[model samples]
Target: MTSVPDERFPLPEGFGPGSVWADRTGHRTLVGRTQRGVEIPIGHGEGEVNPGELLKLALIGCAGMSSDVNLSRRLGDDFAMRLWAHGTSDEADNRYLSIAEEVQLPLEGLTEKEIATVVKVFGRAVAAGCTVERSVVPGIEVTHRVLGAETDAPEEQA
Candidate 1:
């Protein structure tokens, strides 16, 4: 249960992000820890999920969170819903090309107009509010550095 970054990917501090601690648990598997103490399993079918799947989850998770308020206002304060994200990997590019999100919302008793309004509101809310989606849409830059490995501070500075 270890994804020991071989000589191939050398960073010593896990992937490029400063937010996750991807400690190898086994071959191709790592447990990503966040500052909040949440642990996310990561791997290529090794852990709970892979990186690409995580990205899709991020997108849909953001979408649902963003639409929460709007949905509650119209669909009742206790509306129920489930979200899903799907994408296929592009082996040549080593990334997912496009991801699609689906939501199973309980629009049971609402009229056609109400359902339409709810859908529109949810769509607009997600488009304007999901920061994760926004960031992924244009792509963001990720710069990383190996901390504590830079250089020893002088005794006085330390």
Candidate 2:
């Protein structure tokens, strides 16, 4: 099968908070200026996928894309895909500590064994390649500390 043209995909040159550019087709491009800015693409989905929700979707997309790319190389263009992702995050601070997602692979013609293998391979691809998935995984340790004493007093003491 014919492969995706190298020209179709290229890495971005300069990217940081507030960086901006437009493609040859004139599509607008904006670089995140901050953590909040980092997720600007999420707004495109509006109510369906809020800005924060898009962040979750972005993770899924990243993983899904990685899997699809690998699968395509092996299975070619005949395979079709439909991906849906949903998860929760802390809007108060924009911290994401937990997430759950489902990936469906339908092989109308392939055998059950093929489907099982696809799931296994896809899971590995998602786990290994998805930035968000890797971030959520348990191996990474996080530590938080307060530089000074807590400022807020108990409501009863106040």
- Which 10 residues in a row give candidate 2 its minimum summed lDDT? 149-158
Instruction: Judge candidate 1 at residue 43 and give its lDDT.
Output: 86
Residue lDDT tens for model 1, 40-130: 8888773488888788888878878998998899878898878777678779987666665667788677676776666667677877788
What's model 2's TM-score? 0.51
Worst 10 residues of 1 by lDDT: 149-158
lDDT of each: 0.66, 0.48
Off by over 4 Å in 2: 1-49, 73-75, 89-97, 139-158
TM-score of each: 0.72, 0.51
Pairs of residues clashing in candidate 1: 1-25, 1-26, 2-25, 2-26, 2-27, 3-26
lDDT of 2 by residue, 73-129 (tens): 545676666565545566785665555555545455656566555655666676567
Question: Which regions in candidate 1 have their CA more than 4 angstroms from the true location?
Answer: 1-18, 45-47, 139-158
The best candidate by TM-score is 1
